[model samples]
Target chain A: MKENNSFILGIKHGIPICLGYLSVSFAFGIFAVGSGLSVIEALLISMFNLTSAGQLAAVPIITGGGGIPELALAQLIINLRYSLMSVTLSQKLGKTVSALDRFWIGFGITDEIFAVSTSKNKSVGRKYMFGLILTPYAGWSLGTLLGSVAGNILPDSVSSALGIAIYGMFIAIVLPTVKKHLPTALCVVGAIAIGCAFKYIPMLSRVPDGFVIIIAAVVASMVAALLSPVSDEESEQTDEKEVNTDA
Target chain B: MPSMNFFFHLGVMAGITYLVRMLPLVLVNKKIRNRFLLSFLYYVPYAVLSVMTVPAIFYATSSPWSALAGFVIAMILAFFEKSLLTVAIFSSAAVFVTEFLLPIIQ
Candidate 1:
């Protein structure tokens, strides 16, 4: 009964995430189809690969007929951030959630879900995380289906405008914390500057998007972490079940 | 078209992504004691999102002006603490309207 309630709550919280994802994934679906992948292939990619940025980065390589080594390397750099996220989230899981559960959650954790689960005032459990993950998961897959079908029939101007919707979602994610935290705001600015340099600088302009994101994220975050280490209170493990889970 | 190449590329992407995510969860069962590293992890999402949004957002629409308008609308809506759905929808609408009106004005 309790699991059901938490799952419902997760779905509730996920509603907005689902809505945001629908638009973004719709954009991606269009991009994928444009790149020559069939709707089923695009849909499968979105369903199997939930990480938005990583999948977007993969499109060009997949379309280019790049070798597996290049594809894997790109995936590694672009998706590496999730490894860090899962590590942080692992500390928050309680004993009730098993190692197998953690593995499942880890695979499902995206930026939005991680942000929502961690911000809870109380320790998050498997039920809530599961609840939280389910909606966005559906939203992404459904959005891909919608985007793929819709993209082909849409007028060029409308499709072109819809292209930026995913970026808008990214903006929404950062804006909330950016308002409250100086370091977070600066980190964003620094990352953007780094990204721009890669795009504009003659020598570095040829760098791939995945490499650029990896570099910006690593360099900017390392500097922020050093300069603005969070207060001890914030770092205290709040998950009530964290201790028992480790055993 | 050899089906092997297509499946091979997708498989590699999926496998690598899944491994990176699952490995950390399975391997790091203990709480991290290091504050700096924790803070660094905390900022990764923000940095990643920021880098991906800028420059890229500028190119998302047919016209730079339309994309810029939509991006500005998104920032303003986000600044007011609008829900993600609201921000995205309104911003996309902003782009749509701008794209529609641009040729008329020209």
Candidate 2:
């Protein structure tokens, strides 16, 4: 019964994430193909990367004949947050999960997946985690393939409108959290300040956009964590109950 | 058909991406037992989201003045806890109208 509940919860949580992934991946697919990649190549990239920003950043670089080192560096810088996320999620998994399960779970760790999974009860089992990953994984890949193929047929106006969907999904994720958390509010201000600073500062404005996000995330998270540590009581109250129903 | 170069590039990207994502899960699964680290992870998503979103509100426009108008409108709507879809649409619309009408009126 407990297992069933977790499975259901995973599916439920995946719904909004899947919707967002579809729209975003669709746009990515269209843009990628339009940028000169074939439909199959676009599909494969989206399937493996499953990251919007990382792929978007790579598109121009790849098309421009940027070296492998440059592409790898850009992806690494943009995706460094996943390392922090994996460390946190590791604790939530406790000591029960096997290395194999962790392997699969890590493959699905996108910004959306990390956000949704981390927001859930910590004692969630590997089975549910699998469910969450599987649904969105399919949605994102399929959306990419379809969008890439559709790019040839779709009108330019429609494709451009779909491009905006990714930004809309991003805003959706941020708004609800800022409404609830003061530290989050501070982080938002810090991010905007950092973004503006990077844009306007004489030397900084020349840095790549992907690096800016990584720098902003690390600086803002560190500052917010230092300024407002999570209280012991709140942590305890939010402690997820571990139900060992697998046996 | 896609060029061989495109396929090779795509394959390289896929390999690199999978490694970055998979490395932490494998490494940390064996070593991480710190409670402080766990708490830090809990807040990372919100921080990352904010970092990604706030800049878009301003950068969505072509000109500084138009972006300023969009930012003002977006902030007001966001303060009221409007849906992000609503805020983005209204703000983009605000930029378009402001930029479009400014010229006509002037």
Model 2: residues with Cα > 4 Å off, grouped in runs: A1-16, A30-39, A63-70, A84-101, A111-130, A146-160, A231-247, B1-13, B27-106
lDDT of 1: 0.77
- Per residue, candidate 1 scores C-alpha lDDT tens digits across A1-247 of 1222266787787876777677778878987876678888888788888988788878877887655666787678667767776777777676667878877887788766766666555566778778788998999999999998887889987777677777776776678668877888999999999999999999998776667777888899999999998764543332221111111
Error of 1 at A214 (Å): 1.5
Each prediction's DockQ against the real complex: 0.59, 0.33
Per-candidate TM equals: 0.83, 0.68
Against the unseen true structure, what C-alpha lDDT does each candidate score? 0.77, 0.65
Clashing pairs in 1: none
TM-score of chain A of each: 0.75, 0.70
- Looking at model 2 chain A, which ten-residue stretch has the lowest summed lDDT? A238-247
